[model samples]
Target: MSDKHSPDEKDPHDPQGMRGGLTNYGDTDFSLFLRKAFIKGAGYTDDALARPVIGITNTGSAYNPCHGNAPQLLEALKRGILLAGGLPMEFPTISIHESFSQPTSMFMRNLMSMDTEEMIRAQPMDAVVLIGGCDKTVPAQLMGAASAGIPAIQLVTGSMVTGAHRGERVGACTDCRRYWGKFRAGEVTADEIVEVNDRLVPSVGTCAVMGTASTMACVAEAMGMTMPGGASPPAVSSDRMRVAEQAGAQVVEMARRRLTIDQVL
Candidate 1:
């Protein structure tokens, strides 16, 4: 590969060995200056920038209830990063929602993956935390992280808590196929179906059962990418925030160790 930075460039603050692929072509100092200029408006101090940079990918959207807890999670994660003495920066990536996409979310997954990969490569960070809850989003992020080859850890937005319908336990789906089968068979009246629908989704989070979002969370845990018990907590639970905080701490350590994604894989 061609050199990411030109030799003999003087940048005392530059994490030279760590920050690869120049932010601005042929001028590292000016690049860092320009980058700091824009972000400084957000109140980032030089001391903060001096620490290791951990990029937190924001995959949240108003349409994605599965990732509804994203802002809270990001806050918790940032707390962990700060506690662990790292600079945490949250950046956006393509968000894929299972129900909202026009041509089916799967069709747009590849595009999301490309967006993830390109953004990761373009940004300057020692490590990254991949936040995703949707089915295709997790895999797309992983695929991108795999290609990006940076130190990364997967943090799930978490599953929704189970709800209750008319004193009976219900799930977040608000629309399971079993209920549809009952409706189609005329076993359930339209009024009852509507009533059940009203109660099924009690809160904001991913589908409760082993749907794509929850299933992928389990898959992520199985793959050794997620923290222990990362797949179990409900999205709105305090435990989920704890998991995010721990992930932030771990990613900073990963950065310190210079652990790349290939090593983790």
Candidate 2:
């Protein structure tokens, strides 16, 4: 694709051409004045504020380290949206960490879906990028976006790094349980078990196993909800940031193309 844009660059899909739907905002001068005055209160200027709007769904929580990179990802996404000629706005939804919720996170997945659907419905976004990690958050977001039938894309928080112990590579929960079982069976000492626990989850990210979190990541990719190969990036890698940026740019394209979620799903 050509990266350069001439002075006469135009989006064929843009309904109002290069100037956008400014005239549709108002046919009369008084109506235009009221609209501009109200929007200006949000720190918008006539020159910099006519771009399409992109919404970002943030589902981070202190309880969910799988999303530890969320704030950084959001900033990167916003930068990409701005660079791609769109206005990025982020909003929060209920974060459901599998380990933290009671009665199973599965039970509350619908609640998160409802929250996401309602927020997207009430918002003025032309397109949205749903950011999530953990076990159930991604699914809930997908369900809600499907129901809302808007232009939406998904970005996962990425995978966790592998843990290590005395020249042995380990990870979370899976190995955690394995070693704990050994300890319970009197096959390993208490000190060894403690050491295993310390070595597991040495980095900030999701479960380092093919658990629900990883499974959901794979499902998101297989369903074509996310960019190809996005599901496997290590959470702390700089590549994850690039993925976030691309997500922002892609949302703008989706909005311009009017490719709503209903069309994709």
Candidate 3:
């Protein structure tokens, strides 16, 4: 019996790392050849490319303070993926901050969801981590992930720390509304309100209270879309970074197990 095989013969050991979803260039071999050639330009060795690929959505934006910790989260996630024997690939998607978007962030949620779904399908990844912190962003990512039908997980940006105002621990946006009401009733001076403004958001993160962002975080956790205790870590805390790392490592395992999103949802 001959042990030799033709180059065109499918390799039984080929996992869906860089081998999945070949571009329709009318030739499978050429598609893979060109894909590897282009990816190699990014300094990825063939060995690194052989590992399961984990896609991560980067929704960090300068206009979105809620996701300001995205860069740190990205680094932690990559570290975890590498340690777990997977390749992490971060890609940008549409970001919608509630306070910054015109006509409201809700209007843009579907657009972001579509972007997430299409990107996951277009990219070559065995599993994906949806990194988002905004109110609409979490749901948008999940909606897209469900549609994409791959192994998907959600990693929230976490909440903000409480700030102090006049010896009282306060933060947005309940406190913000309280102060505005006080100013309207002549209980607070312009200078006092100005001071309160700085204290409402002492750090860059989502609302400290259980507002939309935090609510959605809990929702994802409850729906089994996120790791255990993935809901309440503050953005600046080391715990959040640990959660990010753990989520990264878990997603790689999910990829290896072929845990599709359909199984979860």
Candidate 4:
């Protein structure tokens, strides 16, 4: 096998490397100069370039309705970062929504982890705010950050709005499954099940109930990975944007403190 595919060839899967294959921008003098020059070409002034770099992990897609607000969230995060005297750079990574993935979302979580870790390491950012929602994205990001060992914070996309059916309130897969189960047991008619399905996910965001998405959000808080009260806000709420902004500002503080992921984890 070629060195590129060789397992002993410095682990293509590893996110920290001098050559910047996947992690740590290839340190070649030419690559370094090219990267800086290209970034400069984007109209980034020297003053802005000199500031601490804050990376935003954007995992948005039509398939992942959970991150439907990714564009707005990222913009808010950038605004906060720049306002706090940090340079913001948004980057893409795998976006896995539980309902959209094949077999299971778990199967792809590790792949997302690899992508996130390598991307974070490859860039020159002093810190990163992981923007994710849904059942698996946050966990995958945490795994990546744990491996990358950089200063990192998590910002959830927030929960979906509650839906109603025939004057009955409902939200997310838990209630979704419950209603469906009732239909399968002949307790609810087919038309009723269809109506319930439409009402279950009334808007774009993560599950409204304290399901996996909410659970992971809480887990992040419990593990001290998120700001206080970061886990419970509704996705479309202004509070969610405030959380994003706070996340951006906090990353700047983290950069100043030189608090690596090891410290936070």
TM-score of each: 0.89, 0.84, 0.94, 0.87
Best lDDT goes to which candidate? 3
Stretches > 4 Å off in candidate 1: 1-20, 172-175
> Which window of 10 residues has the lowest lDDT sum in candidate 3?
6-15
Error of 3 at 81 (Å): 0.5
- Where model 3 places Cα greater than 4 Å from the true spot, the runs are 1-15
Model 3: how far residue 119 lies from native, Å = 0.5
Clashes of 4: 4
lDDT of 3 at 110: 98
lDDT of 2 by residue, 186-255 (tens): 9999889888888888776788798988898889888878878889888899998998898888888998
The window of 10 residues in a row where model 4 has the poorest summed lDDT is 14-23
Q: What lDDT score belongs to each candidate, Candidate 1 first?
A: 0.83, 0.81, 0.91, 0.83
Task: In model 1, state the lDDT of residue 186.
Answer: 100
Q: What does the lDDT read for residue 205 in candidate 4?
A: 91
lDDT at 164, model 1: 73
lDDT of 3 by residue, 1-265 (tens): 8764532244734538887888999977788889989999999887788788999999999999999999999999999999999999999999888889999999999999999999999999999999998689999999999999999999999999999988999989899999999999999999999999999998978899978888999999999999999999999999999999999899999999999988987
Superposed on all Cα atoms, the candidates' RMSDs to the truth, in angstroms, are: 5.0, 5.9, 2.8, 8.5
The window of 10 residues in a row where model 1 has the poorest summed lDDT is 2-11
Report the number of clashing residue pairs per model: 0, 0, 0, 4
Candidate 2, residue 58: how far the Cα is off, in Å? 1.1
lDDT winner between candidates 2 and 4: 4
